[model samples]
Target: MRGSPAGASFSAAAYLADVFKLKLADLHEGLVEADIKEWLVAEGDEVGEFEDLCFVMTDKASTEISSPVDGKVLKIYHPEGSTAKVGEVLVDIETDGPVAGSEAEAAPAAEPESAPEPAAAAAPAGGAGGEYDEQMITNAAGKSRRVPATPAVRGLARKHKIDLSQVAGNGKDGRVLKGDILKFIESGGAEGGLAPAAPQAPAGGAARAPAAVVPGESRTEKVAPVTKAMIRVMEEANAIPHFGYSDEITLNSLIETRLRLKPVAEAQGIKLTMMPLFIKAASMALTEYPILNSSLSGDKSEITYHGSHNICVAMDTPDGLTVPSIKSVEQLSILDIAAELNRLQELGAAGRLSRGDLEGGTFSLSNVGNIGGTYLSPVIIPGQVAIGAIGALRTLPRFDAEGNVIPAKVINVSWSGDHRIIDGATMARFSNVWKNYLENPDTMILNLK
Candidate 1:
């Protein structure tokens, strides 16, 4: 049987010879359900145990599956997008020799008294301290830990394509956690080595590295690559169905209410914003029409309702738009909401928002109106059922009950709902409730109880 290489895929024959007692002939097959990110080895190539065979796509992300043994590639069960479920053959490897039983007779047997040694132990390795040491460290820590960080941390580093080992660890047992990794990543890691050293000066008291000069070259231009998050967000937005709705809201009284609350907010060192007011109004509306605060299942089997009102606030960043949610907005007062929103917005702009900030939002609000837009039909975020777009406030003439034309501060509020879950009447009711709350801002502030 062939020996499997570390980080490469192998056949069942290789597993039996190097790692396990079971033969390739005994194992079942499976199919590939999604696109492969990349193949670890080419076709007709030999693979060893524990090598990454290929990466398969899941709904949220892609995962790499390893080979169980070392063997030659005989067949690939399915092309990309083919359904791979239980008991399906994936790839077949040419076995070195015949096993003890016929193919048809190979069935379930009694459990062995002891499990076989891991195939990684027998594979030839490569790297800094020899392949064996790398394998030992990798296997002992598991791929993620051995890789020295979480996918998020690694992705952040990779956005800059920075190395993890070069960063100092500040986590448990000197292990690198997300925060430590991020700090190092943001600072571009160590200067010359793992530890800081005394500064050295050049002959003429210069401390900077000598700049290189290219003959006849005038200038150099550098371009940064896009981040994975940015790619995923754009793809998801483009691929998903996004519907929008807009309504003009009279914010004259809402603005007045903020003025009244200003003194109190200032006393508490909290700057007031319209966001918390919107959040309050939206939360009230969602309580009356719960379906608007839900998510559609991919299969459309059912709408998942959320008990908490985690309102996602869309903020503009240098990279792109990011929505960091204020969890349980229903439980927060106007002042509390304002403070939290301020902190979240700051963290978001700084590119320091945690994963928790970016996920599990029951609803979202995008206030492009702050930037001078009168109205916009905000796109419904994929996986989320609804998103509201708040537009700029403008003084528009309106007719009163007595037919008198009066100037009113009108703000456009657009609610984009998932057609799969919310109906026209439901959406209209939600909007009306929200509009009522905003127009009567006194009700929200006075009725905080």
Candidate 2:
């Protein structure tokens, strides 16, 4: 109104801006609630379209919510460290135009009839305090570790000149809580007194002294939402009857091929790894044996074969085990697959993968070999008919066709299939096809389209 055009009669209603309510929708499939990790803006602050307003940590990933319109922050419905259910209003912004999702006013928050069952007890963000310390410090090894505690707790510990790392944590995942810090100070910093232990005498031997407690004393931990989701997934997966197969695959040819093409990939700024090769080979095999990519219905009377090879790769992050998938592996070349894998790995490491990244997985693979595991009997994820685990590579001597000893690089590949549908013969045939592709890269390349 202050800057209205010279002959324009501005009505008060026309000049007034509409308030838009920013609600939290489903970030990922199966996500019911999310922890408001932090807020980047406050009420009365000016926000531009697409600007990040809040950071939310869901069971699957940590994501940033953005403002949809240019506006002033009218209100923040939920504070950081609080949980909000799907469809709940997160914030309100006053905008110039009528926003599509704008509501007249915020809806009353819904309250559950009863308290929801505690999710697999993870450390409650902020715990009994609000605002957490997100600063990361480099450890002696140059790796960064995020200290899980509120700013208040950190301040209290600092005021007392206490080293937080040495304080025994009684919170979830052994997070240092304010109460634990107080107890440590009250106990003269002696680990709040060690646990009592009774000595026992071995048969015909002198009484043995009890082992001393470690620097950080033992304490029970509450499971956070991520761990809770993991627990639920594992519990559901356990109900599926499973049968397994394991074999050592010779990977010399694959390794040679990778070495030859490494520079080509580097030129394109892609870090090519064995996983892309494995995933591509598996996808090709699934094309031939679609049954392996099928899912058994809840009633066990129907089997639905998925068209896309959305293969999931298990990743171990700070939050816990997460299996995010690369969509449509059958449609991507080895290099394309490598690029997608690299993207997923980076996002997974940063805990920023979205629901689309995690959902629609038709087959699963776990490359435990990267972390130094030799053999693994990985449990099959629910919904998928099978999952595979690859073990560490080892050089072993073997006899060639001429009976001469040759050093061969081999890795153990293990598969677990739903016993109800996938028989041993079918699984073996499928594995053989996947193995042949890896063993003979030239043939695999010919088959690639």
Best model per lDDT = 2
lDDT of 1 by residue, 137-156 (tens): 23332432233232334433
In order of appearance, the predictions have TM-scores of 0.51, 0.67
* Tens-digit lDDT track of model 2 for 149-254: 4333554454456666677666643445656765786679733322211121111122224446677887565465678878888999989998999988999999
Residue 432, candidate 1: Cα error in Å is 0.3
Candidate 1, run of 10 with poorest lDDT? 116-125
Instruction: Report how far residue 373 has shifted in candidate 1, in Å.
Output: 1.9
Taking every candidate in turn, the Cα RMSD to the unseen true structure, in Å, is 15.7, 18.2
